[model samples]
Target: MIIVSASDDNFVPGLLNLLYSTLFHNKDAEFYIIDAGLSNANIDLIVNFSNRNKIQSHILLADKSQLDRLPENPYWTSAMYARLLIPQLLPQHSRAIYIDADATVVSDLSELWTMPLDGNLLAGVLDGSVHQEELDHVGMGNDEYINSGVLVFDLALWREEKTAEQVVQYLLRNRELIFPDQSAINATVKGRVKFLDRRWNFFSWKYPEIPAITPTIIHYTGDNKPWKKRRAPLAAIYEAYRKLSGSDFPRPRDLPEFTKARRTVVGLFSLRPKYWKIVYYTARCRSKFTTPHIRQVMARASQLDQAHPRKP
Candidate 1:
């Protein structure tokens, strides 16, 4: 199987961690990363990751300027649209899987890879948030809408139907209304998508019950990304793989520079009890809030032993 993903420099760490988790549970595949101005250092890390793990990985060079001509959509960066070029670029591959960088594969991906497209151009999980909007946008029924987060594309069908071209043209016509490439994809391929189990692209925010045993892919579809926020549920799961993988370049907090600075200001001066206690303690100790204060406890015990000299 061939797995495809796209990311810009900002998402390199998350993307690497995503792949590390995937490689942990699956086998015999070539991974493709669609590069959107990834720095040399980051690219080297990714390249070394595949080499170290002995996995076949390729970094497909994407022309970032291509999307610059398209109408800007604030909801998502143009990097997200890079996947649209995959089928055409890698024409040798008959089928492919495209997962967002914000997601981790907690279970074996083989099941999703084997899911038959059944002549459909693509297969994906439903996006209820944009269901009505997508349906209304594309003039399709509510049931026809699917999220592009975790997509299983039938390359042959896509190439034959010129799905990418159609999606781009649709985006141009509906430029004002569409704010995401995902909505555009669904609108263009409305009737041709087969909806899969939600677990395939189980969004962390949408479903309150996340880390559900059934979810093969856990998507961090909200602002509380595991790396940025303090207490996001399922953060431990992401941290597990994050620690297992490299972390040379960590993702900054998911805030604008001004917003992040403002939060830091408040955190530094807030008089609310326990407001900065956790931050200060964690900074001094460098351990999780749940961890025992072993170092301090052991030091106190040592002092007591020295002062009370047992004669025995």
Candidate 2:
């Protein structure tokens, strides 16, 4: 079964639309919605939407305290890790695939679901971009971290391993500085993860680096999301979500400096090699300019609203 474990707060209606799209395109799969910390009213909205659409999938709800025994933090939540202990929660199920709310399936997930666990605790892609910093910051061995954004877990073994307990213990022992849940996962699983292809947990920044594969799932794992108009390289996934949602989530406008600089650099880099570094540096500078800075200076700016809502 393919499962999406999420709370009402992090949950978006668009996510259900994405699930509907996947079910429409692929009929052989079952989706489980594990609703953590949602009111019965909100749960009914989800269930009614599924019923109206004639979508058949299990919809389960639990309070946060019921879902996890440990205290919550920004890095780890009951919804995110519940699937890891799926065997204990739903002991009949021997395996399951976990997806983040900020993702969509482009291809059939059956292949991903069927991936050989090979006695490993988990199977997922390492965030290649963050590998070095993670290793240094946490003192982990090279390439030890795996992005929790997409995980194909062996539920039985994960329960046998008591991974959630280990993760919570790590957090307790470390004095509460774990910023990303992946850090605790890396510490517990250590050398036991089966590295999957980059296509599974494909992030936005690396989209330019690899040729596009019709991925089983596409993850919007960075600040530049498809909800914005500024170039998010892997925006087709969001576009797909937008189509399913029928919501006018307009893409934001571009900053002139970044736009002008990106164009100038791409044009220059497309030319002779000797000037490549100069043009590259200029492009980098443009990319680094903040939207707030642009908004502060430009009177006519519209498209550059903060990707994340500003804190109160």
Candidate 3:
């Protein structure tokens, strides 16, 4: 499996945690880290770590001249657009798994790597946080939108179809999109995407759930990132990986008590009606009403984990 992720200096901790978690779970995988303005010291750290561990790794520097064409936001850097260049970056590989730096893998990715694409150019989970209005704006149906966080890409197909070029053109034309790259990819390859089970790319808001299947990849979506917020949902899992990664980076200071309280109040009032469904789902998951079927599913997943314990 070839795992690709992009990050700048600001996200180095998250990137290291992602690398460690993925390596801990998978035995046969290589990594390609896209350099989007990482400092020279940090780049050496990653290269030295990979060399010390005898891991196959490559650091590809992105072309700033091309990436500058994509619109940027305060919330995300232009590095987010680097995934569109995967086919062009690695011409030797026929397929690759693109995961966001903010996510951590908890299960073996071999299944995801080898899953038949069924002639689709990309495979990813449906975005749970998207609204109907956003879908309409992107000219996609309710079910057509897929999260760009965790994607299984058919690189050869992308090259043949000129998908990267088309996606870049779409994004340049639609700069006002709420989610630039995600909406562009969905719009460009509407019928050509295969939706995977949600467990493949679970969002942080859906934490502590009794889902039919356990989440293999936990995505830290939204602003309350695990590295930045001590109270962020599923943060402990991320911390475990941080320690496992053997990173000596200083931990970020938690938000001040007053600031945290203020943000909570502000967040409450900012919630729109479209978010009520997520609130209800979260409430239901935490409720003491786990069905027998859900229990069985959890048991089976637990058994599988025990059978294939994570590497120390």
lDDT by residue for model 2 over 211-297, one digit each (tens)?
433345667665555554445654644554454434334545665477767776776768956457554543543344223223332
What does each candidate score in C-alpha RMSD? 10.7, 10.5, 5.9
Worst 10 residues of 1 by lDDT: 285-294
For residues 174-244, what per-residue lDDT tens digits would candidate 3 score against the true structure?
87788888988999999998899988898876765645557789899887677888667666667766654
Report residue 285 deviation for candidate 3 (angstroms): 9.0
TM-score for candidate 3, please give it: 0.82
Better of 1 and 3 by TM-score: 3
lDDT of 1 by residue, 127-171 (tens): 776645545767756466677789999998889888899888877
Candidate 3 clash pair list: none
Quote each prediction's TM-score.
0.76, 0.70, 0.82
TM-score, cand. 1? 0.76
What TM-score quantifies how close candidate 2 is to the native fold? 0.70
Off by over 4 Å in 3: 259-312
Error of 3 at 290 (Å): 17
